[model samples]
Target: MQGYKKETELLTKLLLEILPILKAQYNLEEYQSKDFRTGDIACMKSLLSRLKHLKTSKFFSTASSDEDLKLKLKVDAYEKTAKNDQKVIAILKNKEKGLEQRIRELEKANKEAVALKKSMERKDEKLREVMRYNTVLKAKLEC
Candidate 1:
């Protein structure tokens, strides 16, 4: 009886671990396509088959209600994980948009700075020319 209990516990733990992995793998875009790896599918199928067998076995029958309760817990866990992931994705998307806007603002500021620099250079050249003309007129008057 103790051995059977241990076996059931181990099986439940394995199912819990495998559920998350399967969820993650299946959720991936690459795995959603027809080109998904056969090996992963085969492995998941076998694991599910074993889990089904364990669930239907007489050894686990006495605790069938416990198994059902655990299954419910698993479902709840998966749902919570999915919701948290969505929240994180939304936050990251907002952050990305903010960064993009910052980049555009920085680019516009850079362009304005460049134009201002050119304007200043032109003003400096004009001032130098005026000084040269004033010097030439003064020399002519002295002559």
Candidate 2:
């Protein structure tokens, strides 16, 4: 995009320098003096068409011959690529942050589950001790 603007400005500058010569060569001075009639419209249209052709020719010729234009185009492409790379890096950083948060959450849940298992095992041991004492009491009562 930047390259295009530079090229446009250069073409416009070049055309401004060349327009007078072309106008004189084409004898448009006489047409300019004509009154604003139907003839003026037709004459202006012809001049406009000629100007378009000149602009196209000059633009293509300059684009082919200008080293500065080619260099600007390359620089613009490099800047665009750099910008895209930065964007991709930013997105990857965001994903990395999300994955790290998920890993932390999973670690917390695992710790809680381990603590609960330990508590359940202690309860089960106490229940087994109570059952053994009840059997001893029943045996003495029967004797």
TM-score of each prediction: 0.52, 0.50
- Candidate 1 lDDT score relative to the true structure: 0.64
Residue 119 shift from truth in candidate 2, angstroms: 0.7
Top model number, TM-score: 1
The CA lDDT at 122 in model 2 is 92
Distance from true location, Cα of 14 in model 2, Å: 23
Residue runs of model 2 more than 4 Å from their true location after superposition: 1-66
Write candidate 1's Cα lDDT for 71-91 as tens digits: 654665678789999999999
Expressed as tens digits, the lDDT of each residue in 28-112 for candidate 2 is 4644433222234455456657755754764334554445444544555567678989999999999999999999999999999
Q: Which residue pairs clash in candidate 1? A: none
